[model samples]
Target: MSMDLWEYQQDEVMSEYYQELCLSEFQERAIDEFTAERLSSYYVENSNLLVDSFRALEEAQKVSSLSPTSGLIMAAISIEIALKIGLLKPIVFGFVHSEAVAESISNAVVKQTGIDRFKTLLVTLLKEISHVDIVTYKRSGTKLSLWDERGEVQKRRNMISHKGSLSSSQDCQFAIDVAEAILNELLPDVLTSLNLHLQNKVIVE
Candidate 1:
């Protein structure tokens, strides 16, 4: 059917209005996604958790002989605990939903049952805090390389735990050092908030 001049003009106006409407909708969605919520301070109330982890690492350094193996494993665990503290800091300050805690707890249970591919505590903490995968998170200029070195600590800990592998004093010391480096590197804010004065402590303890 042929359209008169006015009919054609009305159709053109309607098409232009439709395009503008779509553009407005797109801009609104973009703005909503681009906006970021202010992150809450996490270091105030949960300071002790980090302090206790540091204390445990210090004590681990002092132990001798075969027992140092246990100490080293505990140091690795302390680092993991500190990272968990970091991840939960936002939750403590009401930055994220409380329901996320319940979800994480349930997922931990399922993981323990070997029902699915379980993420390591460190990996889980990294994702929660950085909102990215491990590789991308590491690219953000974190100095300690926890993604690579912590896995070594875990493997050594596992060997000692599962196969009764002999651990040297050097191995224990390395674990403690790596844990300390990571703590000082990644969680400086959390550490400063704890007022633990960790930098002054002796490395060998």
Candidate 2:
């Protein structure tokens, strides 16, 4: 289905669920306000952090050959900052989506079904955010197995952080490259997911 059609359908489903579940008006309003305030604050804080990390990474790339240990340290710091910011963007977006779903569901129930079912809608919205896989960590030999690419990225990131030993210019450059790749591939995807969740008002269930 077209994205717009899919979103309309989701809103319809949420409306039905809300009416069927029967939530209170007060509870529904509270969830809406709370979600908005929290999401706004989270976005402000995280976006700034993301920008700062991006600037640092750019500066690092221009530097002449760095000592192995320095390169690894800098790369590790940059990656950590980038990943944390990336993860936060989606989570905040998911939270906003949940809130919107709750609001839409509440409105639909009151308007169409004449039911007071806001509590269940709010609970379900929270549960959806709770379950979303906004970020995943891939350690070696873990239950949620890392694919080859992710595994390689993780290894390189780790080497930069833990290897500490002197690395050649090539090794340092490689670490920087890995960090750059992760930032490029993961950040945009995270932002897009957040925007989709917000625009569509989708819940996990």
Candidate 3:
């Protein structure tokens, strides 16, 4: 088949790379290993969900007084996103060779679980991945369990999203508290385990 200029250049690059790999001792791995090694770095670099979550939290805070309902929704969304990307993805990726498989399983686990089972799933994920005792995690200056706060805030968020119910400033603050607690308490450990660092609002190793 005739190749375009870009295709010809690509083939030449691949050929040179293949020849270099053939001579290298590290090239003896299986194709899946090669794929994983090449793709895993890309996944980690792009998959820091906390970056967006922080942005959401900031927005939630700004709108808390002006629009409590919006604040509550954004806060809840941030927590949900952080739970999946910050906690779930890197944890599950460690157990799989391919990022593709880890991604599919993560999506399915989050999607298939209903609201009733959400707490159980969260408990299991935190326990297995972070070894965190969810029951003992309390919000700042309050005796409220972080897990229960997460549940209540999220339930309110669901009511707002599904039934178009308006939220009070207190509810917005409640959701924000949950977001802040999770971000402060859980994020550091999670980031450390993944060898990730937050710098100037960017997440990196």
Best by lDDT: 3
lDDT (C-alpha) at residue 95 in model 3: 42
Error of 3 at 190 (Å): 2.6
Model 3 TM-score, all chains together:
0.67
- Where in model 2 is the C-alpha error above 4 Å? 1-41, 44-46, 64-68, 88-164, 196-205
Please state every model's RMSD to the true fold in angstroms. Answer: 18.6, 17.1, 11.7
TM-score of each: 0.52, 0.42, 0.67
Cα lDDT listed for each candidate: 0.49, 0.46, 0.64
Over the stretch 30-100, how does candidate 1's per-residue lDDT look in tens digits?
32322122222233433344666677787777663558777777787766655444433332223223446
Which parts of model 3 have CA positions greater than 4 angstroms off? Answer: 1-44, 113-131, 193-195
| Model 2 alpha-carbon miss at residue 54, Å | 1.5
lDDT of 3 by residue, 34-140 (tens): 33232336445675557888888999999999999999999998887777666544444444455676555444444432333334434544454446767677766
Error of 2 at 92 (Å): 7.8
Indicate whether candidate 1 or candidate 3 has the larger lDDT.
3
**Model 3 clashes, total count:** 0
Backbone clash numbers for all candidates listed: 0, 6, 0
Residues 14-128, model 2: lDDT tens digits: 7666555444543444345345345434554435546655665665575626455466456655665554343433232433346576445434544452111222443344334
lDDT minimum window of 10 residues, candidate 2: 196-205
